[model samples]
Target: MLPRIFVVVLDGLTAMHPSPRIDRLYLAGTLVATSLLTACAVGPDFTRPTPPTATRYSPESRPDHAAPTMAGDAPSQTLRIGDRISAQWWEQFRSPDLDRLVRRSFQANPTIDAAVASLRQARYNTTAQEGFFFPTIQASYAPSRTKLSGNTGGNSPGIQGNGSVISTVSNTPASQGGTAPFNEAVIYNWHSATLTVGYVPDVFGANRRLVESLQAQSEFQGYQLEAAYLTLASNVVAAAIQEASTRDQIRTVQALIDSSERALKVLREQFRLGYAMRIDVAAQELALAQAQQSLPPLEKQLEQTRDLIRVLAGTTPDQDLNEHFTMASLTLPAELPLSLPSELVSQRPDILSAEAQLHAASAQVGVAIAARIPQFSINSTLGGNASEFSQMFWPSGKLFSLTGNVAQTLFDGGTLKARQRAAEEGLNQAQAMYRSTVLTAFQNVADTLHAIHADAHTHAAAERAVTAARVSFELTEQQYRLGYVSYLTLLTAEQNYQQARLSLIQAQASRLGDSVALFQALGGGWWNRGREQRAEAAPK
Candidate 1:
């Protein structure tokens, strides 16, 4: 056995004494007993909080129907309940650019790096504190030149010859000297080398509770790291999708501006020839300006979004992160996992993190309770002291001491009891927070589930609108070419097609984003990846 460090305080004993051999045996026995007793800690042990009793995420579950859209690349998605999520969930999108960007972000995001560092630091602290379970050993050497005390308290040290071990003048205080220890008759140099050992027995489990709290904190950091990973990946995906949608919108708006320009040219000619009114020509100009105005802002947003993606991937805004993404390139997975409500409790990082806080708080309560009880400690110093440095380790200079201590607070201003109560309250707060986190997680999943269901129908309607608008615009344009339709009728057709096309892109993007949100709400499958995988998931 790796020397178990747990020690138990024997209660109700004011003092005890034993020989060194017996002391060793007693300590060994106590260590073994305490190790067994500590199988139960002072406070309530942490049980993984039970998942909500509800069976479904939402009040009314809808079937995920496959509805085809304008783009063939985005396949219809279906919900797969109680299915496992892969560690590399982003790969389901099947976009090389998204895959590469997410991979890079895992390596480069500053928030992820910071969280990783914090987790490492917490692990170190917990590991370092394990030593507290064992006795503390320290070695010391102190050599000092000091005047001899009168002797024992009142007796003289006694006279000595020139070569005596006491010293040449190891006698009493001078006949006319000052009183007591301050009036030393001789001075000598003593070199002492001692090894000391000390331990505070954990009779009430205070030390164990402390270690438990630290362990919970470390676990909390681990979940926090997971949360950072989920947030960064989702953000990168959202920004990429938004950028692609805006690019498509810009193209559509530019085409509208071109159409407006053609109408304006025809109107100007007609106005000069006394066929079209100046008011009609002015309206065409205004329409063209409005279309032109839409392009710059979309262009600006796209550029800023691309820069944001680079930053998320841990690159400077100017760095060439070569990944280029578009809606067409992203493949919507046919099947998406919808975890059971119970599973989400284990999966979500924030909820798990809150649970960890609750664990820590519970342990703190135990520690507080232990503090109000009696404490026991033991220490020993074994070494040699000599008047001459060279004789420090000699038999004549040998010295040793052992001490055992017990302390109990008979009376106080109720401070310790108050702290114990405060710790209990903290536990309650943590419990409440954990519940709230779980509720919010369920809400997120419900919202995303609804969005995904509603988006399929919405995308279906948009596809039909685009198809109808396309047919109408083409016929109207041909009629205008043949001088059978007025400019206003052509303008309306153009606007209808543009509006339908843009709405389809928005719906398509919304569906994709909703998929991302569902993954996020379900904890992003961090458990599928081990700690090492998560810590290094980003681009190397």
Candidate 2:
């Protein structure tokens, strides 16, 4: 294919000359010779590795649907195998604030910008490498003035006293009383214009293999960019979930503190009336202090989480976001998409990127093999030279030359063979890395599946505990007011309710977070990113 293009280019260059027939025949012969030389490439071609044949990600049997929990109307998630995930999978949470934050991060994040720049750089480098397939044509003009010394042996038309031709050469210096030659120190302008064309035929396909390697590198960078997008979106979702969980925790602690303060006021009134001991008031005071102590850490955590979200959205810490998340605001998706093991290799960007690296390494081996063989090149120049610029293009001053060269290294101390071995080793390394990435991806899915299953049951149990604790605390408080139960028993019931509430909140948040991880591990639906979205993301 490349040879046909080269032939057309050579034909075009020949067309610029006056003798169309002879020039066409000359270029045709040259093209035939070079095309025969580039017939075969020297090394291994790359093939994609086979996908794993396993049907499921985990060794142990897992339930398709997680146990139903009391959080958010008892929403239970079922694994829908072979379902198509949306490109914007984060929207499954049904939070408009989260959707806006993710979209904004895609536009503003520095990591994403860097990845896009890298992809463009790789594409440009590949284009530069492809230019080697054609010949290099250059046009140059040089005009200069030069003078010749008198002592050199030369002759010119000159007048002599005895009608003999005079010589323009002298052995004696002009300062030594000798007559200066007529042409001595004479200056003249020399003008030359040349069009040179050079081509190194891909005799062993070295240039072809080099171009193939660069193309594979560009493909690798493209996958890297996709991976960056997937990572950023996942991070934003997880961070928002964290913020909601912390806020809930802080709110729970504050409610507990207020209840404790009211109980302490009743104990002080009883002690002033001599109906309660001083120890009872001190114990209530300690419980109130403990509840207050928990609030500061939760507040600190909320502030730090807010800062992280700001940075993820590509803004400074002082720049606050208009959107905020709460447990009530985010919905738990009821259906989660699950991909088969066979499709994982094709879906994951890290795996694809690794495969591209292996391809480049394979092409490098071809380049090294070609290096051990002979290289061929042809150069031609058509131009004219004259003493005056006006006559530079005249037929009398025409110049033409065609040269062909062949080069082969006699010996290089086995350097070429060593490089070939190194390239093969690199191929081996990339293959191993690809396998490792596949294993890690499978592990991620398996772990998230296990977490989703366990989190549902944990949240359900916490809900039951909170219900019992709330009933027990209410009964104990009424009994203490009626003088039928001690103050210590009421305090213990309240403490149990506080712990149960916090546990329920954490369990609920885990379910949401693990759902996001499952989507990320399944490749985040990057392949489904449609043409419209791509066009929107492209540089204007």
Candidate 3:
């Protein structure tokens, strides 16, 4: 039926020709056959790179639980292997402020906005490329006045009188040429209307491959958007944790300064009563000054961390954030979800995005191969041209053309072949990059796991050290007052207590921060939120 329709159209275009009808039918059938030949794509089909075959992320077995510290109320965390991570993973911390801040960042962050815009752009471009699969039809109408010179060979547009041809013409000036037959110019109005149809039959699947490449690129952008969401959320959580940690450090240093000030006062009174040496008072004063000196940096760090939280929440530094973070305000998740090694390949956005890029590269190889083959095109114009608009569609004024073309690069100095080779190399490059992304992803998980494990032990040790140091410092302080120990011993005990207190605070924060890292390295559980939901969250 399609071939018959093509024959009919061809017959209408070439009606003035004395060509046989069978000849037109044969040509149409040949074009139909050519279109049918493009059943397969030219290059290798894409296959997802296999997931990692390893059973675990680390070489050695990980602990079932993190070591809990006795000094703080923070609980030990248990690792739940092959557990499903929630899409709202941050909620595991049970901090409403953190949850609200992360949500706000998702809505207002510029990075997320940029990624959304890129995804939309890619989708639009892919849709545009798909238009090539259909024939392009356009219609136009033109009306114009044209004049032809009489010098060209043609019959004069005048009445023939007697045996001699006589024509009426404008009077010739006597000065220019005494008496000469006047050359008349012909003027007429031409009207034309045409409907042109053009199509490039993808005889080698070039357009199909092109469309496939664009679709893969769009897919890549979608994953990039997911990556952006993951990164922004992770940043917000980490910044919040850092803010909490810095605040705790500041509080600890302030406590140390207060304790030292109290000690300095006691020493001054002892010296005034002639019960203590001036050097002892001077040493206590120096210790107090040192403790006081540490406060400013901690204060500065706290302020900077607050500013970072503000920015991460997509607000100016001058703008105050209503939500403030402190260690007491955050609850470390007791249960940590760990995905299997095989699941990680599909979980991480970077790995998935790399896979999409590889897919696009594979499609590009097909496109390049298709380009080396002969290209086919069919164009037809169904229109009429006449001197008057009323007669434009008359049979005598009908004008039409049907053309089928095949083009091959005969002598391009191997440009086509070189392009094909380049595409193949590009595919290889994508493969390498994909593998690199997978390796990096695995390394991230392994490193985070190790850090979490180490942080727990460090936290427990720091807590014990703080307890021992506090007891020693208190005992030494009383001994110094009772004339049982030197002021240097008291000072040494005080310094040890101060350092231990600070280390305990750091260890607590590390335990929390590394937990965040573990969640992030495990891909933030984005897959729990299906693609459609995530895409809908993007800005329109």
Worst 10 residues of 1 by lDDT: 6-15
Report the error of model 1 at residue 126, Å.
1.1
Model 3, 352-407: lDDT tens per residue? 89999999999999999999888888888888876667766766667777788988
Local lDDT at 478 for model 3:
97
Model 1 clash pairs?
A: 106-538, 107-538, 107-539
Better of 1 and 2 by TM-score: 2
lDDT of 2 by residue, 1-540 (tens): 435544655554564445544465666676677778787899998898888987886665654433232343246777888888788999899999999999999999999999999999999999998888788888899998766455443633233222443344444556776675433543455678998878888888898899999999999999999999999999999999999999989888887887788778878988999988999899889989998998998899889989999999999999999989888888889888888888878888888898899899989999999998998898877787677677666655666666779899989999988998998898889889888988888888888877887787777777788888889999998999999987756866887798889988898899999999999888889888895488779999
Write candidate 1's Cα lDDT for 408-435 as tens digits: 9978999999999999999999999999
- What pairs collide in candidate 3? none
Q: Write down the worst ten-residue block by lDDT for model 3.
A: 157-166
Better of 1 and 3 by lDDT: 3
Best by lDDT: 2
lDDT of 2 at 325: 86
Model 1's number of clashes is 3
Residue 168 displacement (Å), model 3: 13
- Per-model TM against the reference: 0.85, 0.86, 0.86
> Sorted by TM-score, highest first, which candidate order results?
2, 3, 1
